[model samples]
Target: MNYGPLLFLGVFLTLASSWCGLVLIPQLQLWKSGGLEAVKLEKTGEFYPPMRSGLAEHGREVYRANGCIYCHSQQVRPKGFGGDFLRNWGQRRSVGRDYLRDKPVMLGTMRTGPDLTNISLRQPSASWHMLHLYNPQITSPGSIMPPFRFLFETRKIRRMRSPDALDLKPPFAPPPGYEVVPKPEAQLLVDYLLSLRAVTPLPETE
Candidate 1:
């Protein structure tokens, strides 16, 4: 009996099965279904209140320009997959609907820093984020993340320090007569970061 045909058929079938199971199936389920829901959300309105706003939209551009995706990721792995659960990044596995509105999905590869999928919920204060962006060390002492001091402006005080001025201490603080305020780009970027949170729960959890 000739085994050449049998061997070739077996290899082809195995490849076909793998492609269907791994690629085609997930594409149909995740992409097709999600694409539909995204359109429906636009037509019928969002299930949850709109979170991402104009400020966040502009801030996202600023975030991209700064290459934040290089160091920080915006995803959370499932409980069994990794330490994401232990790190308390999110209560549930991040789903497609969570980012349906995002035009340029930023599901970053590396986790050089903590996940930002739910950072807004964890740290809701705008002031805190401003301070952190100005100098990561102020919030996370000895942090490897470099300070974005260029995002801040040191201006001579005219009256009292602006309410938005950073309360940097000691070595990080501005000169005696100067105060540091986040630039417009920095403000927008922080707004975008503050908008990141898993507000819409999945049906499985509901």
Candidate 2:
């Protein structure tokens, strides 16, 4: 009795079953669940607000197109790794429940830039985000993040343009002659990015 054929058959069966159990089963569960809700923190604060699914969907497209996942990661590692735990990545360890709504979660594998799970709290200023998006080097002198100038418009205005001229709602549209304008997609992306704040409060030592 040759063992080679038996071994090959056994390995194939194991892989096939594992694939179905791990991949297909979980996908079916998600489909049946009609999307999962994000886990809420025990104590709420002025941190990350509830994410709009519509905005998140649009932002997902932006993330995919801009390849942000290539440089940034969404997952926070457990403490004990050199400076990572010391860094303000998150208040507590990230759990799967935190990303229940993320169909194809953006838990990237690289670390070209720091983790952005808690970026909103870390740098919540809209102006800071605008400048950084327009030109990464302006904020971080040595940053390697590419400038997303295409997402914004640069123009010189002698006088302020009416809110109706830009055809955008107030607040988002700059006052007349603002010099720079964020495209609709850029604004949406910014809104989505700003919404990525980690709402979980830091654990207190009892």
- lDDT of each model, Cα atoms only? 0.83, 0.69
1-206 per-residue lDDT for model 1 (tens digits): 47999989999999999999998997798875654253324445666425578999999999999999998899888878998888889888877667767778899988888899999989999988988888888888888888898999999999788988988889988889999998999999998998898745556334
Q: Cα deviation in Å at residue 30, candidate 2?
A: 11
Instruction: Give per-model TM-scores.
Output: 0.80, 0.72
Q: How close is candidate 2 to the true structure, as a TM-score?
A: 0.72
Worst 10 residues of 1 by lDDT: 35-44
Best by TM-score: 1
Residue 131 in candidate 1, Cα distance off native in Å: 1.3
lDDT of 2 by residue, 19-40 (tens): 9999999878766663343434
